[model samples]
Target: MSLLFLAAVNVSPEAMAQGANDEVVREAQPSQSVQNVLREEHALFSDRLTIEPGISYSYSDRSNLALSGFLALDAIFLGNINVDTVESHTTTFDLSTRYGITNRLEVELMIPYVYRSSQYETIGAGASTGGLVEESVSQGDLGDISAGIYYRLLPEAEVRPDVVWNFSVRAPTGKHPYDIRTNSRIVDDGEGGFENLTVPTSLPTGNGVWGVSSGLSFLKTVDPAIIFANIGYTHNIKRSFDDIGSSEEDVPGEVNLGDSIRLGFGTAFALNERFSLSMSFTHQHAFETKVTTDGGPEQTVIGSSANAASVNFGATYGLSDTTSIVTSVGIGLTDDAPDLTLDFRIPFQI
Candidate 1:
């Protein structure tokens, strides 16, 4: 298990903060209010601009396999062993900059990196399973890359509060670092000890992820607090990594790619001008699978879908008029993640 929380560190989100007006934000310009910084503001510009470079840390707990039905079987078949099936703590950090174009239309770009360490006990399966040592997977460099654009629509309408339209993207940039596989089967429940049968015929591989995501977001002010929600679709391209296994005498690079869809909702509450908190939830479904081999025909694996759920909580505290400290935590309610996490951040407008 890693020490960092994969959920706590996202380079780019719909961008929820104090500035809900229609404007353009980038990653190069600096902000006028070094002490007054928006949690989601990132940009770099000449005149009306703001630039922020921040790092976030989080601790989390992980559990069961990400996929439920046959997909779980496939994950086990590949190299995604361990299946967690338990809770573990994690943390993360992020660095990014944003530029403000105008006040109504702004664009921001950010890149987040993470480090992690986790500890879990591997129980016994049957006479045919393998066991894992009760230890931890120390640390690593980075995670994924995410970016987004926000536009304050209905600026004049003000039907209720503030509403904005947003679009975002996520790229596969995390550590494909390898570790010893765990032996927790869906039926066993970590009872006895472990079995070698749980082990694949061969070694596992890394993750080759390339994805693009976009969604619509809304923000409404209730007193001193802002409630926001977003629903979007994440169409993940096929994975390019390979998993080589030995079916008796087959040593071929066996890897496949399939598309997936995800939906999410999040909100933030402000206590005052310098302090605020946020929460978010998201669900994912993996639909189809397509695989090709070295000396075999292309195979399309169908009739399988996996489901996942996630929750995130965070807070911001002002250090001065131009600098503030932020802390956040994340929980993988469902099997979609590895464990639970706690994260921290520091931001200031330049």
Candidate 2:
């Protein structure tokens, strides 16, 4: 891998775009999900309302300049390099919806229209300082919008016992504009740090932060080729009513991602008349970014706990008798998000 790491792996397909994270001091921000819902697949139909037209590819390499931790003594007050690495990417066009409003209740709707791209590099400590400074940047829009709701107080399909409850939201419309700064004062900070609470997650378009997610998930099923394993946890409460900045230099404190705990497990197989296969794993934890500057004084940063786990292999082809079609591919043992992903679903019954 060396066309410069294969063009950083084909620009990571998009690299989760827009300032892909790295900031701190906190004012409340952290709650972005692409369905870790116990590895997804729970709709025993009680009311029915499932509409999905999905296509997702989320890649992340997490690194956009470390300079040397805690701003590394202000990097000699800004002269040149010694940070090491940074990466990003994106690809989306999802239209998810699930509704079973009765038997334990349910509600969810997720929409993503991302086409983002990114790249950044810094490795200087030679030539007396100034040896390597990579450069790469890309853009695309119609991203940032995740809705949520789920309630299943026990019963996602046995385990010794089970549970589920949730709520999620992250809307900005996506195209950029929350604080987009960088003329080189140390560059890198496109509002992905939610302005300056240090960091939790953001990409800006218009007033962000309004995530209220609850948690509880447990399951275990292993029998005659219908195996299983699972665990989950969710917690987020960020609210920002809108304050672009310059109102004495807004801060609007309210952040929490110090890692909201989401650990998953997967295993499935029912290769029968139609066919079946599955795999799953998940993890979450990372936070401690404090940036309070309404009156100034509260600038902390040092975060690295956005771990990801995935492994899915599935297929179910049956196009008749109610119809059926499912395909999946997710690979990323740990990089927090995406190293590979491919999914498809189609179920009918009218």
Candidate 2 wrongly placed segments (more than 4 Å): 1-41, 52-83, 89-93, 97-114, 125-128, 139-350
What is the Å distance of residue 35 in model 1 from its true position?
11
* Model 1 per-residue lDDT tens digits across residues 7-96: 112122333333457365543221222123234421112223344555544344544543223444545443324444333333445665
> Once model 2 is optimally superposed onto the true structure by TM-score, how far is the C-alpha of residue 45 displaced, in angstroms?
1.9
Alpha-carbon shift of residue 229 in model 1 (angstroms): 0.3
Residue 74 in model 2: lDDT: 50
Error of 2 at 21 (Å): 62
Identify the candidate with maximal TM-score: 1
Tell me each candidate's TM-score.
Answer: 0.60, 0.26
**Per-residue alpha-carbon lDDT of candidate 2 for residues 220-315, written as tens digits (9 for 90 to 100):** 434433333433444434433233332335435433333355555555554444445555555555455344434556555465346666776765
Q: How does candidate 2 score on lDDT? A: 0.47
> What TM-score does structure 2 among the candidates reach?
0.26
